[model samples]
Target chain A: MDFQTILILAQDAITNSAIYALLALALILVFGVTRVIFVAQGEFVSYGALTLASLQTGVMPGTVWLLLILAFIAACMETARLLVSGARHKLPGALATILAPPLAIAALVKICTPLHLHLGWQLILTMLIVIPLGPLIYRVAFRPLADATVLVLLIAAVAVHFVLVGLGLLFFGAEGVRTPPFSDAQFTFANLNVSGQSLCVYATTIVFVAIMAWFFNKTLYGKALRAVAFNRNGARLVGITPHLAGTFSFALASAIGCLSGLLIGPITTLYYDSGFLIGLKGFVGAIVGGMASYPIAAAGALMVGFSESFSSFWLSGYKDVVVFTMIIPVLLWRSLTTAHYEEEE
Target chain B: MKQFLASISMLAVLAAGTAAQADITIGVNLSSTGPAASLGIAEKNAISFGPSVIAGQKVHYVIYDDATDTTTAVQNVKRLVSENKVDVLIGPTTSPTSAAVIEAVAASKTPMIQLSPGPATISATDEKRKWIFSAPANTTIYGTAMINHMVKKGVKTVSVIAVDDAYGEVSTAAYKTLSEPKGIKTLTIEKYKRTDTSATAQVLHAMQGNPDAIFIASSGTPAALPHVALIERGYKGKIYQSGGAANAEFLRVGGKALEGSFMLAPPVVVGEQLPDGYPTKAEALKFIKAYEAKFGPRSMFASLAWDALKIVEAAVPKALKKGKPGSEKFRVALRDAIEGTKGLKGAGSVFSMSATDHSGVNQLGMSLMKVENGKWKLEDHAEFK
Candidate 1:
């Protein structure tokens, strides 16, 4: 490849790496705090992008109904748990928190749809509709099995992924949709032209990463989540509820996944089931981090993006096989370098 | 007269006491919820307009969503054959699933009206295709039309990128086979997964050759990715799509970037623009009118499904006279009747099925179309043969 082509392909890989980095961080974050593999984490990306597409077209997004339905189920589960535990006093507040966001968002979507709200409002609305789904998923599917083995939780996560995929098809229909780019402007540097959408992705990724760094190091809930990540029983002894930590981390993960979707939506067409492969690539990056370090995971995702970009160029037919096969070596190094510990369960 | 004939067949078909013969069941397996849903959903939606009663006996369609997975498609085919006792099978849409279910259908001796990518070259000696007939134009017809078009335009070098599946593999092969003999040198051939979110590497690789033209051999909206990416990079050469992106959605998805690109759509899609002497024009106009009247917008895939049933409808009466509807003999008769199809009007093509040619559509079945201002405009009424 010539210098210009190399530069262009690198640009493409970097744009992809930005999104994969977010996904890796989300995967790592969820796995750390919840001990759940969080396989359905990618579904949120489809949901976020699709919901925005629907909203942009001035129609009520299917996410509104999905959110309400899931919210109702979450409310019932939380209500049932509270009654069983004799925490009846906490029931009203818990129910309000569980049920209100989806209902309010549904109402907002219904109200604002015909108004043909601008893209900014629509994006915020999209986030509002999809973000709560994270915690709600935790409540309905994961929280009930909180004490279960990681394998069981992993299976549940996969099942949830399939269910979400089916639901995505129902809501979004079979045809994929692409949103207009955030900005259509082009930038050129040293004979290399870059798209505005790529810039948007880069800016958003950096800002989100910085915010995540700050949240983990500075905020109380973030510290609680970190404490929970470090030691569940130890944090519980100090009055940190692992349940809250799990929900918080899922929320963060979903937010990251949703943003990744938004970032990548304009760049390509995302089908109902596109997120799994994207998320799997991120998981490969997480493996690069040895599932422990955020910085290494992000860098690994860049490596994956570069390899994927270059390999597809060199050997287009075997790109996926090449990209997925990357996990083997990182896994080998991981197994060889890390000291094995007794089973956590 | 129709009612009288129907009543006669219904009465004759119902012999309750001994292995009671009943409805002419057509088992449909489609990928309505997965990657191939673009093709499957349209076909599924068009099922509502299918003829309910053929030759005076009720036609029962046992539709199942195979979710675009081959295993699920095979299972559905089994259930449709053994459980439903279908007289014929309509789908297992998408090429891989269609190819996968061929063995099962051949085993059960049920005739299928294949709806996805027609194989590039069906060997006349192949026994498996005996019970199978396709609804759409095959890869050879598409590849030939595209190659001939490129040849007409004096294009000497080309690149091809297709989905890394049964359809793409065959189309890429067809391009190389057809284009090379036509004096066009293929610079590169690339493949990407159908469910892939991006085609950066494939696009970059394809562009590296800087060939005179690029042929994207994928179907549906996914085809738009490389097109859009190519446009983004300001690659100003001609881009061609196969018949797979005939739907309006491909145009919508790709939007402004797709303008001026060429695609080979079945002549039915551009029926109004076709010359009156064309065989499929009248039926094409009728299907477009009827389908759009119900569904609002016209769809190419939907018309493919409609045309499959048209062939089935034409064959049923002749097949009905031979044996009872549920009998294996009736399926055999149906298969024979379908194979005997000659000069029959369909939405996609005037099918002329025979012993050797299952999807008996020639180059005339497809027309060269281009995206002009985000809509499919007929470029050449391709009668290349």
Candidate 2:
């Protein structure tokens, strides 16, 4: 009720919204281009947070091993495909593609983690280790079933989520881990003080959003992605590779998820399973946006964050109910207003 | 030749029966790999230190992982009773799982020692709790210790925020029962689910009451959310946490935000820091040393398990005088012997059980601890006034 209290609540809402916005953006991007719900989007978040935590302790994270394994598997699949197609010359290139990045990343991690490198480099290393897992997952799980029904792809995504969660537990253990804040400074504005971490969240979110917007509107690759999202068959007819678009979308989404995890890690202790609930919140945001418009999805995510913050004040026990219930009216309105169309077989 | 073969078979049967009677089986069902795995793993480690022989009888342990699910715990208790035919049952770590196994233990009339820090509601009265006993101090002791500290500090009003689970509900109820009679007004009470990421709304609502203190009744890493939010909102009042949050993981996750927060924990948490004359200090230190030597650090749940085993060790000799180790009569004798425990100091607390009270430890065994510089420090005295 007081001015200061309201300001504090607003700050909390903004910090939470910033993270949710990134998740929503990632979800929408992957779903748009790939037509997959990407339920395992949150696993990348956990991976990112835990990877940083491991690096902070001056130990090489098991994530590097996971990356190597996934990359090797993806490479084998590609090699097998080339061999089956009788493309003998491309087999060596395929092998190189599968083997090089993971090995280089593993070597870099091995050298830097023991040195107790600065937090900035550790964060970058964490991101580098986690981001490629996205495309590798897509290649191994989703791409093979690309011609399958959307329902089948969604089930596969759920399966991936379970596998990643199990793997997360094996790597991180049952205990939750928290990292030190990026900046320990506090800024005072008369009656209010804001942590530097909150500022970082806001700044990073804004920058990433702007970068994504520019990329989607201006770049050739981005335009091609938009084309595939618009109509996959039509984009293929125009010589744009659908597979390339899917891989790019998945990679970008994974990066967004990792960044969100890094930003939120200092604020809360993260376990292997923490990402699913957080990602589900973003899914709620995506639904409010009708799963199509990026700006609207971001706005919806902020709404969710604010509603959760304020509702926890008004009805602490039912805040989750309140936040999740917001979707009901949106769903009802969309059902009544939007046209229903069935996809062609 | 046929008569000789029959005699040999009869001898084999008698020998097997004698071996089973001489070996006393203690079944341990714990949450070793689930949401409560951290606590369960600690309990498992402590129970490992139990004696291999008790009262001149071989003690054999049969351990099962319940994964913190109530259904699994119940199933494990059935298997331990019907299949293993164990003479005693040790655990199922968290309060809910412990509560779930009560019926199974009671049905089999098996003596069970639970290691959860909650009220022994599985059997409320002396007659009903004949087969059940708990190791940790009751939830009411935590409430009394906290409220006594509050009243000493001249705190007249407080607000409550707890997780909406069995542990949270019991602790909050106990706090309410103890605080209100002492003229401490509870301005508001709020609840959140266990896995919630933020408690901003709860903190804000609690702040509106403008109480002198705030008691958060959640446990583990999630317990840090409200404290972090409270500090961020600049609400500087006394913050109290329940015993469930008395683990090192809470501090590691909470960081500087939890500094100066008060909690009522068993003495084992601050064993090295306890006064020399403290009754539980020597025993607590011994267990801590042995545990840390093996597991890197001693946890509250581990201490509770160690204490439970101590109670068993103390009761076994008394029970043995009444009947043989494997008989139904021996199980009854063990239950009676445990109930008769008085002033027996163990790792976490001193036990003094009676027929009416299955949870024998009280506020005397609990110490007031405050988080200082991200570590628990024992307050020399509870008299803040």
True contacts kept of 2: 0.57
lDDT of 1 by residue, B93-210 (tens): 7777887887898899999987876553243357776888788887888888888888888888888888887767777888888877788988888888866767877887888768
Top of the candidates by lDDT:
2
What pairs collide in candidate 2?
Answer: A312-B201, A313-B201
For B1-385, candidate 2 gives per-residue lDDT tens digits of 9999999999999998797777889999999998788889999999889999887788999999999899999999999999998889999798889878877888888899998755555453645557788888887888888888898899988999998887788889899889989999998999877556667778888988678999999877678878887887778899998877887778877888888989878888899998777788889999989999999877988998898899999999999899887788999998989889998988888899987778898665788899898888997333211
Candidate 1 lDDT for residue B73: 92
Which residue window of length 10 is worst by lDDT in model 2 chain B?
A: B376-385
What ranges in model 2 sit over 4 Å off? B1-20, B124-129, B193-195, B380-385
In model 2, what is the error at residue B9, expressed in angstroms? 14
What is chain B's TM-score across the candidates, in the order shown?
0.87, 0.92
TM score of chain A per candidate: 0.98, 0.97
Backbone clash pairs for candidate 1 read B6-B56
Question: What proportion of the real contacts between chains A and B does each prediction keep?
Answer: 0.76, 0.57
The candidates' DockQ values read 0.64, 0.52
